[model samples]
Target: MNLFAEIRALVIQNLEAMQSEGVLPDGLDLGNVTVEPPRDAAHGDMATNAAMVLAKPAGLKPRDIADALAGRLVADDRIVSADVAGPGFLNLRLAPVVWQGVVGDVLAAGTGFGRSDMGQGRKVNVEYVSANPTGPLHVGHTRGAVFGDALASLLDFAGHKVTREYYINDGGAQVDVLARSVYLRYLEAHGQEVAFPDGTYPGDYLIDVGQALKDKVGDTYVGQDEDVWLEDIRNFSTDAMMDLIRSDLKSLGVEMDVFYSEKSLYGTGLIEAAIEDLKSKGLIYEGVLEPPKGKKPEDWEPREQTLFRSTEHGDDVDRPVMKSDGAWTYFAPDIAYHYDKVQRGFDALIDVFGADHGGYVKRMKAAVSALSGGTVPLDIKLCQLVKLYKNGEPFKMSKRAGTFVTLRDVVDQVGPDVTRFVMLTRKNDASLDFDFDKAVEQSRENPVFYVQYAHARVNSVLRKAADAGIDTNATPDLALLDHPAELALAGKLAEWPRLVETAARSNEPHRVAFYLYELAGDFHGLWNKGNDETTLRFIQEDDHAGSVAKIALARAVAIVIAAGLGILGVTPADEMR
Candidate 1:
């Protein structure tokens, strides 16, 4: 149960009672009213802005409403004290039984304790890791992949029907380059000496794809001209690349529910239909874009192109959909892709893109707005670059990738759990410094290890209690948990339900990582305290009843930590070597 929500309901109910008693007006809007944990825990357990938000609307003084609301709230069984504070903020202290019940709730719910219904079963499509299939994913794409996968899991835990998707960039000139690159590799497989031209891929990963082609088609296009082999090789190479990409993602613990093909939009008239819809809405028009403000030259001339009125929604300027030569611009298929998402009947859409694609956000949102008629909402999250370090120096390129650090390089070096956890240690929009050496260090400096240690410590306690013959099945006597350290841990546990809703509302999965770290810190702090105080020890040598109660609390922390890690797609460590 969400204690914060329960208290907020109490406040709302009391305000409704105040309306009946004429202490507040009847038709006041209460949407902005909120109940949350007080910034200073010493002040109280929770605080509400019911009075401050209602004061101006109801034409009543803030203090007057707060005092009346406080009196009514304290009458509830869960509320031990409610005090009106500065500017009519009401701080509430819940009964000890309330904190005590959180342990039972965690045990009862297990991994599902913090799961929320904030999404209300709404369908959400989270499209991420749409890296061009011309090559294996790099470190930059790894962050986006982990972020998107975790976000999908988080949304699912928050009651959203989430669909994880990947958009293939196979319809562009890049894939044509990929086709020619593979043809060269295929020639090399036949023992022909070939030099990779400027635009052809030189990575060794394609060497296998080349051999596979030789095995399948055996001299069919061995010496054919570009026109004869280009089309067949393009399709063949992309399928092989996608297969390699899929394996790479699987290695990193990411699985996509859908892999949408951009090439499919070409032959099916989808791009034309998407643009036609925009044309029907008067959003598409023939226009000449202004030249760059400072770079307008004497020879600069206005060129007419088919543009989408992106500014009408929220973009800085209208964007081109088709070039002056009648070819669809790069933005056309993206628009059609989102339009397809809208047609799929998703209530919301989210795109996780690399930070370099920041410029595309506004226009893409504008397209979704016009296509969905402002009904469905789209949220674009851009993951910034990851700078890698090893031995306190800049890490060099991967030999296998033949260029930058591949996702597999990172995952193989530190394993999937460390890679996923470290990738999320920073906000998506913030640049992350991933140190291969420090990420694996088992110390407080490493957040992933620190958090895992907390889980491991909890398991250690359970093991000790079991060996001591303590009956862990006994119902925990939470009244015995009166120490301040114990209470602090309960307070952290109480924030889970609220934290899940907040993170989901903001669409920030990093917040879950941050919360779990803080929760782990509190749990560890409490465990460390028991090191000096014998009574605080989880396993009492002669007090089996008290030992069971304390073990129950430790297990409760593990339950929440496991649940949080589950949302992050990282497995909890029961034993850390």
Candidate 2:
């Protein structure tokens, strides 16, 4: 159970009682009232702004309301004391039994302890890693993939029905370029000399595709004109490139529920249907966009084009949907894609894009808004660049990927768990530095290792208790867990449910990583404190009941850590090597 929520219910109930007693007016808006952990742990277990928030609204003095509320709150045995802080904010110290019950709650709930129904079963579509099926995914896509996958899992944990999607950019001229590049490789497989001009891909990874094509059709398309092979090879190369991309994602433990193709939206009425929907709303019109702010009138060419009145929905300016030649602009397909998502009946949409696509956020959101008539909310998260370093120097490898580091390159050096956890250690909008040396180090400096070590330590404790014939599964005398360290660790455990709600609400899975680190730190601190204080030791040889009580707390730490790590798609280590 959420202790904070229960206490807040207590506060609200008391406020209602005060209304009946004429201490406060009836029908006061209590929406602004909030109960949370105090800023300073020493202040108390929880703090509420009930008095401060209601004082001005009720036309009453702050201290008078706080005094009345405090006197009523302490009537419950769970609330040991209630003291008014600055400006009539109420700080509350709950009885030790309250913190002790948190351990029991965790042990009882296991990994499901912190799961929330904040989403209320709403259908949320999270689209990420929409990389073009041109080549292997790079480090930039790695961050997006990890962030998106973790977010999807986080939303599911928060009780939303989530769909993980990938939009394939296979409908562009880039695929034609890939076909030509593969043709050159095909010629090479046929023992012919070939030169990869600037526009063609030159990676050796394509060598196998070329050889495979040679095997599929022996000497059929060799020495042919562009028309004979372009169509067939374009389709072939796209399929093969998509296969490579899928492998890249699989290497990092990512799997998409859908692989939507941009080309599929074409050769069909989908784009026209999406535009017609907007047209019916009077949002589509023929217009010319103004020139850029710095451009001279003489140098700028203003062409009349088919445009979408994006500003009506929230874009900075109107956007062109079609060129003067009646060809669809790049935006037409994206609008159709989101329209497709809306047609699928998702209650919300999320797009995880790279930082470079920040400019497109407004337009995409505008398109979705108009398409769904503001019924479906769209959120676009941009992942920033990742800079790799090692031993105080920049580390750049994967010559096959040319100038960039492929996702495979990173995963090959450090396994998928390290790669996934490290990618999430930073906020999606912030640049991240991935140091090879630091990531694999076993010390506490490595967050992945630090968090994993905590889980491992719990396992170690459980094993020791089992060998000593201590029945950890038995109901323990949790009331014996009154030591300050024990209480502090329990306090951290209680924050897990609250944290899950906050992180899910903010759409920030990185917060989970941060919370796990702090929780691990708290557990490790308590473990270390046992070195000096005999009473603080978890395994009390002479008192099996006391030992079981402490082990319950330790087990609860492992449970929460495992749950947090599960959202991040990292395995919790039973024992670290």
Candidate 3:
């Protein structure tokens, strides 16, 4: 029931008719032809660029083509009027019945009304919040978790088979630091005083993990040296930290379909295999790299190292896969991780990384491009920092995470819904300001509340109508819905299918959030109009059939709002009170 699509099809059909009549030349590329809502609603219901795009190709003037196209379009019952705008744009106003049909289609399709098959069941792997298996997830990972989860749902709605993945960086030196930190807490559990040095984690979150270790194996590693206990404690501590991270994510309504272990890439030959794939393409070689642009390391001597010819793809410089000391560089394992994703037969890969990892983006894409032989497309989204405020001042740090706020801290302060919604209010690349004072406020200024109140108001109308003995179960007589206000709401409803396709095509889930807000605003405006004009009210006291038709319109809005919120992992509010 995409009215824009339907209108575009009609335009293409008319163009084909014109070509057959030899009015326009054959073989004009119509790929660039687009039909969308006019910028100014007063101009028309929809506009098409078909005339402008085909004019030069057909060796005809834009206005001439537009005049011919307009004539063919108005012949159809759906199109009430068609006029040529500047140069060659075709602006169209649909018949009133057309808008009524859109509302009816929404009720019939229900929540699946806007679902798109644009992705065509392609497999996509989305990896996010791969926070080191060290301690509780902090505020930084919260943005990525919400963004990735919403994006997975969006892709799924657009018809992509998506897998939500979290890569456990257990093979890194950070996990070893976590192991030693937990060992100190373990000693403290055994009644031994311990001091956390500069590199050790001093957070009290590890205190319970240490006690758990003692409970599992009492006195086994007591007074043991690093060589004897390091490996076992590393595995044990990392598992416990992952459990903490999983709990943190669950509290925020995030669930991962896969948790890939970096350690698995180590013991197995996956790294060798991934590098071998690149080597076969003559992309891997032993070479020396120029020191990084801004800063050179203290040990800055140029030495031969295993490098990937990332420059051939799109990276600014070739990147090192192995250090001079024969140890796998950090980039090597990441390359292997992406290779594993490609081997799993996913048609696309999306990585949600923190802003600091922006420098790592190009090389990572180059690796996936080379490994997948450009068959798999990879997009890396960088979530910027979040600034927290309370009582109009900067929020204090958590004693648990020591230097930053934990995800649990934000969730506990305001429930997951507010946290998730406010987090998405900004673009992933822009810095987000999460205000403790304003987000939970039950006022129109708060977007979360504003949008939820709109949904709740619709529910209120249905409940009141039911109490007033208006037969709410009757099918809406959509033909009676021809008022300007009703038609306006229906026109907004018609944009949902197109919005979903565009948002999913760009891999941008924030567009969903923005669309939901605009829809809510339109709905709220219509509701307010009912206050001054009794006829615009959803419930007509004396007319049961007209009331059912209006209620149907309100219900249709609620249905799409709930579906959009579901995609964002947000629970639709039933009542504001």
| Superior by lDDT: candidate 2 or candidate 3 | 2
In model 3, state the lDDT of residue 283: 100
lDDT of 3 by residue, 117-205 (tens): 88899999999999998889999899999999999999999999999999999998998899999999999999999999999999999
- Quote the positional error of residue 352 for candidate 2 in Å: 0.2
Model 3 stretches with alpha carbons more than 4 Å out: 294-299
On the 0 to 100 scale, the lDDT of residue 179 in model 2 is 96
Model 1 RMSD in Å is: 1.4
For model 1, residues 455-548, the per-residue Cα lDDT tens digits are 9999988887778788788888888877778877888998998999898988999999999999999988988888899889888888877888
Task: Please provide, for model 2 over 101-154, each residue's C-alpha lDDT reduced to its tens digit, 9 standing for 90 to 100.
Answer: 999999999999999888999999999999988888999999999999999999
**Model 1: ten consecutive residues of lowest lDDT:** 479-488
Q: Over all chains combined, what TM-score does candidate 1 have?
A: 0.98
All candidates: CA RMSD (Å): 1.4, 1.3, 1.3
Candidate 2: misplaced stretches above 4 Å? 297-299
